[model samples]
Target: MTRVVFLLVPQVHLLDLAGPAQVFSTAADLGLDYRTEYVADREDVPTAQGLPLRAGTEWPDLESGDLVLVPGWRSPKTAGGPRLTDAQVAQVQAHHARGGTVGSVCSGAFALGQAGLLDGRRCTTHHSLQDELARRFPAATVERDRLFTTDGRVVTSAGIASGIDLALHLVAVRHGPAAAAQIAREMVVYARRGGDAAQDSAMLRHRSHLSDAVHRVQDLIDVRFAEPLRLADLASAAGVSERTLTRRFTESTGLTPLRYQSVLRLERAEHLIAQGSPVESAARAVGFGDARMLRRLRSARFQS
Candidate 1:
């Protein structure tokens, strides 16, 4: 089993801790081999919400494939927000040194910085603290207005709800996009938004609608994006006419069905190209007959 240990700081923001915890918890409920726990420097920690939280004072033994997360706390500008002690910071560093993944949410990036994990690596924090984080840690590359950033084994997320997206991204990395989508659906999240350009999977990016018909159609397309699809079949699956499906899918996702498939194919082709596959081979693998149309679509997508 993979252990997901959260380090609780005094005056911790509830959502910053709970959001990601819920993601992993839900994954466990869905039969993923994840074990979640909470730890802190002290046994009783006060929360920003005026509640007291109990946690383990001792650190658990962690190995490779385990995760250590630091959730954001009350701002430095506020009273009662505790900073990580030198000992706590060392714990985070040691976990990463042992090949465990470390992550932070919002202002929790400060803890990671103190541990030297953010040095010379790309990361992010809440928008309100972006400038201050940069000023405090000059060597860390702070990205503004991102949902999250993954630099090697260190992951950082923006304020509040973006933690859910970050955790879902971790799930997608470990399991698959299909598993992440199922978790989002069970949690009633509309869609997973991207960070810093189109870093989210196509299933996530195109899943912001409330229509069950559209969601069913998107589910099919998500798994079979590389295969040829017919409008009549898609419409039939959604129990709608072809024209209605086109209009509704456009209104909900801002893309026609064929256009959505093309975007997925384009994204896969780009990934293949990045992995050292030839353009022609990548195009053929994604169901395109040749590289000509793929090149044209890539240029048009990038230019537009």
Candidate 2:
């Protein structure tokens, strides 16, 4: 079993710890070989959420394939948050030196920086701290807008909920996209966000609209984006005329039905290609009749 050790700093944000913990725990429930433990320099640490969490004071004996994650704590702007000891910092550095992967969520990047892991590496933290991180670690490359960044064996995430995304990404890397998708579906997450800094999945990006008609149409397209879909059928399911559905969907999501489906297809094709599928195979797998159109679309999208 792969061991995932979480270093719980004082005044840690609950969601920063809970989100990724839940992902791994759920993966284990699905029969993945994962074991989780919580460790801290002190036996009991107070959280920013007004609860005290108990943890082991001793670090576990970790080996290759083990992961150590530092969850974010209360902002340094506020007083009385936890600080890592010299011993704990050394432990993190030693783990990375021994080929173990190290990760951080939000301000946990500060701890990793203190461990000297951030030097000469590309990483990220919560957007609010990006400037401070860059200033503190002059040699580190801090990406300000990314949800996360992984350089070598180190991974760091932007903020609280992004931890779940980071963890799911690790699951995909370790297992496969299918496994990550299964875990995401079981978690009721609509779709996994890609690592791209500027864009999120269409379902998430367009979900803020309050139109029932548009939402119904989106639900249909999201599930069967790889299949041929008729606008009239989508309109009927949404209890609207085709023209009305078109107008409302465009108003809400800024994309027509066909365009929305194309985006999903392109996203899937990119994933397949990243997994080593040939362009032709990925194109066919995502419902393109041939690679020519896929190539054209990809070039057009990238250029624009």
Candidate 3:
């Protein structure tokens, strides 16, 4: 059995808390022995919408679980409440040390960050707070655009509705892809977007800092993913050795030039597929050349 604790604070986002609760409750309906209880520092927690949630468990009486989700808090600029006090911090830290999976939605990342759980971890928060979060926590690698990021057992998601996406992803990880797909279908939400998709978007956003030559090469590749890319020509156009371009591109983006380009093509192909294009035509349009090859790749990477 997996027990999930929802740590509620003053002015929590009601929907953010409910989204995961719904997903896990569905898991229970499917005959999984999962339990969820609302816990708080006090017996009463208020929602940002001015609704009140009645906490069923007291903080010290709460037991560690297989997972815990903290919904976003009201912005510091907007709400007044206790910062995660010393006891709350120690409780969450102890849960992590016991190999429990923990995560947050939106500003709940602040609670996790404050507890020292996000140090040296990659995390994303609501975009509005990205700068302040980065400045406040130098050890965390703040990702600006992802809806969610999961490094090992600690996961974090971006603003408001993205909490649903993160919850679905956790379902995929905890149960299985088939189970997650079924849940998404039942919930009328899109299937979980793979982590690779999130990484590619983040990498491309950071690519502008590369040399002018690199940007030029990337631009050509972006506009012509269906065409053959020549490493020598790309290097020549950038006025750098192939090795130099590769190293710098990888360092800046965390992906080699070729892998990044392939991801771009795949992303386009996926869009085409979603628009009802025939698989073979979409593959050819993306430089994959064969529908079978694309199928194999999708199965290997995303099990679609």
TM-scores for all predictions:
0.66, 0.71, 0.65
After superposition, the stretches of candidate 3 with alpha carbons farther than 4 Å from their true spots are: 59-65, 78-82, 196-304
Per-residue lDDT tens digits for candidate 1, residues 1-304, read 9999999999899999999999999999999999999999899989999989999988989998999999999895555246788889888988899899999999999888888889999999988888888988899999887889999899999968899989999999999988998999989997666556343467788897898989989989988988999999999999999999999999999999999999889988987886579999999999998999999998997899
TM-score of candidate 1 on Cα atoms, chains taken together: 0.66
Sort by TM-score, top down from the best: 2, 1, 3
lDDT ranking of the models? 1, 2, 3
What lDDT does candidate 2 reach at residue 141? 96
| Better-scoring candidate (lDDT), 1 or 2 | 1
Top TM-score hit? 2
Whole-model lDDT per candidate: 0.89, 0.89, 0.78
Error of 3 at 55 (Å): 0.8
Q: Looking at candidate 1, what is the lDDT of residue 62?
A: 95
lDDT of 2 by residue, 1-304 (tens): 8899999888899999999998999999999999999999889989989999999989989997999999999885456335689889988988999999999999999899888899999999887788888988899999877888899899999978899889999999999989998898889886577555432455677789999888888899889988899988999999999999999999998988899899888878887887689999999999999999899989998999
Which residue pairs clash within candidate 1?
A: none
